[model samples]
Target: MAKSTHDHGAAFRAGYVALIGRPNAGKSTLLNRLVGEKIAAVSNKPQTTRFKILGIVNRPEGQIVLVDTPGVHKPGYELNRRMMAAVHDALLGVDLVCLIRDASVSTGHGDRFTLDLVKQSDKPALLLLNKTDNLADKSKLLPLIEWYQQEHSWRAIVPISALKGDQIQELLDEIIEHIPVGEQLFSEDEFTDQPMRVLAAEIVREKILEVTGEEIPYVTAVVTEKWEEVREDFTRIYCAIFVERGSQKKIIIGHGAQRLKQIGIRARRDIEKMLGHRCHLELFVKVEEDWRDKERLLDQLGVGKEG
Candidate 1:
């Protein structure tokens, strides 16, 4: 047998932390707050997060890779199935699991189901009671925290309001304390690991969600066709919005392309803000009948089939 020596010279604390919760539990909001940036898309609708978004948070102690997962829900379609699988995949190799629950609402089956997943995992778990600011009596939170502590031996119990930024710093400190020492995974300045193209597509998709209502937003997909950086100042980007039918395309385009123009203007402003530079955005509407069901299209859209 050969002896191996472990190298601890470059020891630093860094690991993956997954945020799991029910629909509209403010997981995305919490992630953005922690990272101090809008990396994950946010919407009022349920299941707004369709993928496991990796947000990198750098601190003086170490780096924390936050995985903002899609809201766990019963799948109603193939897309939903893929989204749920993303959530499951994020659980693997996670150092800490922050099970966020809306403090204003009572615990339900959805919360229980996610808690069961955490209970089975060997990873350390933290119960995050979100939306504490909305609660009338802060004293009521103690019982809920006690209930969770009784149900499971959690590593820590934290009450916070992701929207109001209450107790967020304390939560970050707690997470950092539990992270084991290891080498730095990313540079101090790097905020996220996501590529620019993926982020650009997400920006447009988020705009779609913001502009439209009902099932149309869910059926929509944004694809960037070209990205041309002009000199060192600005960039010109072209994208196509895919819909399932001609009727849906018309809805997105609206009368005389008014809706599409609105989406473009808003998406451009957001992209510029995200990139920290001006952008010339061009948006077009296209009908890709049942693209969600098409394996090729789904794969092209980065919605992989493998779990």
Candidate 2:
């Protein structure tokens, strides 16, 4: 990752900055943009981010570890209950908190739920009105900002387009000021802390989310079963996509395994680019009989993992 040249002799400041919002509220996009890497899983589908994704942003003044959490929403399944737990955990012991809201969407119960969390934090928090580009009337922003202003006293509020990279520099400028002075937490060159196996599974899961529709993506979980790096330039990974029932397995594998093959082909391209190694990606479908409800599998999925 390329970083802006900063005066190395100057004081270094770094700390954790949590990005919280409702589902599909652009938290992943903002993390990717701020960190200058595609490490987080992103999809139009809700809850694309299931756990805390750590992204390191290196600036001359300081390094910011962006903590991306699963969107805040009412829990239905055991997995969702764990996701909400992650959101609460991320808010604790963080140097800063950023509540990212989709400016295009109207304020509702979900937004209020997130805002309530922000108010509870009572720490240095920034309200990011994200996806401002999607707003049909730019003038509507003033009222939206006013509403949040009335809701809580924020350190700063900035409207940005995470997808378009609009006003991001301004956002960064604001973020750095709030981060306390300290030494860099991570090496400047490092972009993410996720291991290759977890990332590989996430890449496959992202592809699954993109390829499938309805409840299939939500019902699915990808686990890396094997990773072989026998050669300097070649690697092989085997992953199992777990579903609740055999019928869901069929949906993922498709007829004659064509859909699964497509998933592998597409995922390998991204895996190779991210790892800079030729990867032989293999995927398998398995029915885990409601694996989301199984506590053991949840542990393997990085649930209850810290930021």
lDDT, candidate 2, 189-245, per-residue tens: 788988888888999999999899888977899889999996999999999888999
| Clashes per candidate, residues 3 or more apart or on different chains | 1, 0
Tens-place lDDT per residue, model 1, 210-257, is 888787877888778899998677999989888999999888888888
Give the Cα-based TM-score of candidate 2 against the true structure. Answer: 0.94
Candidate 1: worst 10 consecutive residues by lDDT? 1-10
Identify the runs in model 2 with alpha carbons over 4 angstroms from their true place.
1-10
- Cand. 1 Cα-lDDT: 0.83
Q: What does the lDDT read for residue 142 in candidate 2?
A: 86
Pairs that collide in candidate 1 are: 12-182
TM-score of each: 0.92, 0.94
lDDT of each: 0.83, 0.87
